[model samples]
Target: MILLFQQPELPKDQPATETQQYGFELSDFLSENIWYLLIFVLVTALVIFDYYRRKKEKNNGN
Candidate 1:
């Protein structure tokens, strides 16, 4: 399993610089707006379900 976890070797002449070696970390976009998106999706799903339920009931009653 060591081969699976092995670190790739850089070129012999091309040494990795500090800035190149360690780039800036990326922020988690989903984690930031997770709650807002979750609420939005939940509300949308509920609205769609309610719409379909009402439509079905109306059709059945007719």
Candidate 2:
């Protein structure tokens, strides 16, 4: 039908607002546990570096 093909009218009411609540607060958490955070980062970096080094040595057959 022609009526079915016609575009619908926009609503008179305004769109609803949204509230964002959840997110990471890294600054706060890091400041509270600076030493632990530093140790964690250092250990993670060392592990990643060792992994790549071992992979390179293996690929070179040495």
Candidate 3:
């Protein structure tokens, strides 16, 4: 079991290679999902809110 967990040693003669860095940014997230998708989601949320608000108001009035 210990042998299965052991990592093979890398040769020291090979030169190190540069790795590309990944970073998160607001613009990247917006572009990937599409900005209009986010806006429509917000509008849908507002509509749902107004629906519940009206329903509560009608119940209280009766």
In the range 1-62, model 1's lDDT, one tens digit per residue, is 87998779965788777656776323455777789899999999999999999999999999
Q: Model 3, range 1-62, lDDT digits (tens) per residue?
A: 89998879966776544332345667677789887888999999999999999999999999
Ranking the candidates on TM-score from highest down gives 1, 2, 3
Report model 1's TM-score to 2 decimal places: 0.55
Per-prediction TM-score to the true structure, in the order listed: 0.55, 0.53, 0.47
Q: After superposing candidate 1, which stretches have Cα over 4 Å from the reference?
A: 1-27
Q: What is the C-alpha RMSD of each candidate to the true structure, in Å?
A: 11.3, 12.0, 8.0
Find the candidate with the highest lDDT and give its number: 1
Over the full model, what C-alpha lDDT does candidate 3 score relative to the true structure? 0.82
lDDT values for all models: 0.83, 0.82, 0.82
Task: Give the range where candidate 3 is weakest over 10 consecutive residues by summed lDDT.
Answer: 14-23
Q: Lowest summed lDDT over 10 consecutive residues: which window, candidate 1?
A: 20-29
Superior candidate under lDDT, 1 versus 2: 1
Model 3 per-residue lDDT at 34: 88
